[model samples]
Every structure is written in structure tokens, then in C-alpha cells.
Target: MIVRIMGEGQVRLDDVHLAELDELDDELLAETRSGDEEGFRRTLGALLDAVRRLGAPLPDDALEPSELILPSPDATLPEVREMLKDTDGLIPG
Candidate 1:
């Protein structure tokens, strides 16, 4: 799958990493549900780091669509809430 880190380029991830990503997604949901800003930041940082570490970065010129679009580290709670609402579901799949 191709995942996009907003403001950054895209990264290609394989099924092998989906399980870990799912766990991170679960953590993100929990943080959002409870409105824990600190945990949310930590979890989001971990998730982003995981994606960067495991996925191969695509060139900025690449025009392919991103299967998953992730928020930037500076994203606010409200922004993420809205993004989640717009997405059909969690991004692990």
C-alpha cells in the first residue's frame, strides 16, 4: 500500500507491516476517544516513525494516489477528528 505523510511525499508499505500499523491505529483511536493530548502526540509520533522506518519513500514528483493519508505532527485534535470522520475507516488495512 502507498501511504502519504501530508506535507511529505509518499511511502510504500507491504502487508508485513499492516499488523503493527493496525495496533498503532488502535492506539490513535483510543487517544482520540479519551482526548489525551500527550498520549495522542506520543502515539502519533510512533505511528509516523514506524511508517517512515518501514516504508520506502516515493519521490515528490510521484503522482500516484496514496492509499492512506496520515496527519502531520503538528495536526490539532480537531483537525484529526475531522479527518477521521471523513475517512471511511481506520487506515490499517
Candidate 2:
């Protein structure tokens, strides 16, 4: 089953995905510690995809902003920047 994270809430993952992600995260940690480029890339890609699916818009959209503009014009840029930065260049245009 797919996990759903509603707005203003913590993200939840399916058990299988969570387990796999945990393993991948562990592997990522190991890879980072050991300087394994391929492992790091795979882990990073998986995590980034998870994040994107949680919040990103459809790929067909031509005018996607880094952080989607909500009703709040006074939104903090730093938080938005952090979320986008967390994507680690995994977001496709």
C-alpha cells in the first residue's frame, strides 16, 4: 500500500518501503563513511524519489517552482530552500 502524508503532517511510509528505506539509509550511511560512490548514488536517488513523491507536482507541469507558492506570500525562504536542497538535485525539470 502506498503511504500518504497529508499537508502539515509527518510523512509515513508503508512497512515494506520503510524497511527497504531503512536498509538503504543504513547502506547510505555506510557508503558515505566508506566513500562508496555507487552506493551513495543509489541511496540518495531512492530517498530523493521518496521525498519528491511526497510533495512534488506532476512532471508534466512546465512551470514548477522550487517551492510551490501557497496562499502565504510571507512564507519563509529558508525553509523552502531547505526542502529543495534536500532533493539534492534529484528533481527533474
Candidate 2: regions farther than 4 A off: 1-17, 51-93
The TM-scores of all predictions, comma-separated, are 0.91, 0.37
Model 2 C-alpha lDDT versus the unseen true structure: 0.41
lDDT of 1 by residue, 1-93 (tens): 899888888999987998898898888877877789989899888989999999999888997888888999888777777777754336745
Local error of candidate 2 at 64, Å? Answer: 21
Models, CA RMSD each: 1.6, 11.8
Model 2 error, position 75 (Å):
24
Best candidate (score: lDDT): 1
Clashes of each: 0, 0
- State each model's CA lDDT, in order: 0.84, 0.41
